[model samples]
Target: MRRSRTGRRAGAALALTALTVPLTVAFSTTASATAASSCYAVRGPYQKQAEKFLGLRVDGRQSASDCRAIRAFQTSHGITPNIGYAGPVTWGVMRVVAQQQAAGHQPNRAHKCPTDRGRIACVDLTRQISWVQDGSKLVYGPVPVRTGRNGYETRTGAKRIYWRHLHHVSTLYHVAMPYSQFFDGGQAFHSISGSVWSAPGSHGCVNMRGKDAKKYWSLLKNGDDVYVYGRKPGT
Candidate 1:
């Protein structure tokens, strides 16, 4: 009877151990999955500035799409290990670039832009701003812009707007180039999202705000002078 009691106790202990081990493993697995699914969220003061720059809603909330956009921008600008998180490095780059643009300093002091000034679109690459002038008189802008990145620099010097498309889509990149006015080969001035101001750059085009782009489309016609001067900052 004593032996049987001992045996029964051992069997119960074994069964309990078997059940507890699986339960512990299961709990650990669940905890790991939850942690993995949770992504880092962007917030604080820089969030507003980043949103404005990226052309996203100025709301201070960071969404999944925001992370994705941030990742895309990081990838384009050659930020390593594009993990889609807006950490210190990302925010620092944006602040520096924005400050440079706000300074409105031109790189080409000697280039007087002495061509057909009757109606011209002048792009100051250093300032990252565009303006429409009618014979030295400013018609529109000093508006913010995003030019091409390092490798695909926007061609500097004199050019002419050869084509105009109100609703143009790029065949190469397949992205929309709204209110596009092609000045250089496969390069144009068009409207892009505010997010564009964040980082990376257009392929070879001058990206303007949506409102500014529409204004340019209305103000300038095809075959107008498009003078691009200065080097884009950090290029």
Candidate 2:
């Protein structure tokens, strides 16, 4: 009788274990499914603003695609970490850009520009835009730009273009830097890969789009003035 009772207890323990295993697995699976579907929420009108700026569908929701687009924008603008989330810092940058666009205000150009310079390349670090001016006349555009990342901050001051290279290669990074124009030390203005528009930043140079860089190469010459001003937001 004692042996029979012990065998019954062992069988009962195995049955209980079998029941608990499936329950635990089901709970874990449910939790994982919930997490996979979880989405980041953008506060206020920033969703619409970012969508418009990125040319994404404005669905008023922070979907995975929206996050990817925001990450691309943040990466291009030198926002750190590139976590693919639209948090406060990301939203703040987007908000300022949206407001500037809405008001038709050219960032970092509200103050008086230098009149003595003949042909100038004005870099607005705040807005990540660059333009060319021939003595107060707008010669080129407010095109998108990618400046230096943290620790390799681009110098913000007056500089003069000292050299021009139509096809240059970086000895340090071993990458192609087309339409290179040296201004301050090793820092230069050049055309980077299209990935820069969806990646981090350059070492200590001002990066421009391919077409803009070509235009710059044609418009600017050696000894021209390159004025870099303002601070990149969320640096």
Which structure among the candidates has the greatest TM-score? Answer: 2
lDDT of 1 by residue, 82-124 (tens): 5556666677566656655564544223445543468888887
lDDT of 1 at 124: 75
- Candidate 1 lDDT at 100 equals 50
lDDT of each: 0.76, 0.75
**TM-score versus the correct structure, for each prediction:** 0.58, 0.63
Give the Cα-based TM-score of candidate 1 against the true structure. Answer: 0.58
Name model 2 segments beyond 4 Å from true.
Answer: 1-109, 195-199
Q: Tell me, what's the RMSD of every candidate?
A: 11.1, 9.2
**Candidate 2 clash figure, as a count:** 0
Clashing pairs in 1: 53-194, 54-194, 54-195, 55-194, 55-195
List model 2 lDDT by residue over 136-157, tens digit each: 7778777777788777878899
TM-score of structure candidate 2: 0.63
